[model samples]
Target: MAEQGPHFLMVGGVPRDWRDKRTVAEAVFNDPLPFLDVESAHTHEVLSSAMAAELVDLGEGIIDVASVRGRNRLLTRAIAGAHYSGVIEI
Candidate 1:
């Protein structure tokens, strides 16, 4: 199968930005409270990698964004870093 969207990865214990689907799927998943913007997906929501990293750092052991081994490193790291667990769509 071919991955077809912007993928994310966990770097430096945080989720960084990348368009690689394979890399985004190999990891867990995370959902930040302040980062939720489901209104628009076509227009790029401006957010820096540093900010994202900071979010992950703040949410350490409190979230999971992983979907595969290395595909979604950030997701996986977030999952490992989560403090609370539940369902959230953002």
Candidate 2:
């Protein structure tokens, strides 16, 4: 037998705009917390991977962003630089 599809599809990380507008990276690293409510909710009300990573302080390993759009190199670099981890796509 042979595989029909990719066992693992690799992608980049979260976009700069998406993270800047949605996640609490700025607040966590800089700035002050005024409202303390920085969660970004889509139509389905689901937390983004970037937010989740920030919350948990993602250090390393591949980040699965299959549901997100506009993934690119800059996003990956930003996340990796922030966490100082080797973040890749899975």
Where does candidate 1 stray beyond 4 Å?
A: 1-70, 83-90
- What is the per-residue lDDT of model 2 for residues 1-90, given as tens digits with 9 covering 90 to 100? 556464443356445775578765543447532321222233112233544555344342333443223345544445445333423221
Task: Quote the RMSD, in angstroms, for model 2.
Answer: 20.5
* Residue 13 local lDDT, model 2: 47
For residues 4-64, could you state the per-residue lDDT of candidate 1 as single tens digits? 4454433553433333543735644585444443234321122223235644654433222
Error of 2 at 86 (Å): 13
Best by lDDT: 2
User: Which candidate's TM-score is highest?
Assistant: 2
Which sections of candidate 2 miss by over 4 Å? 1-64, 67-71, 85-90
24: Cα error in model 1, Å: 39
Error of 1 at 83 (Å): 4.7
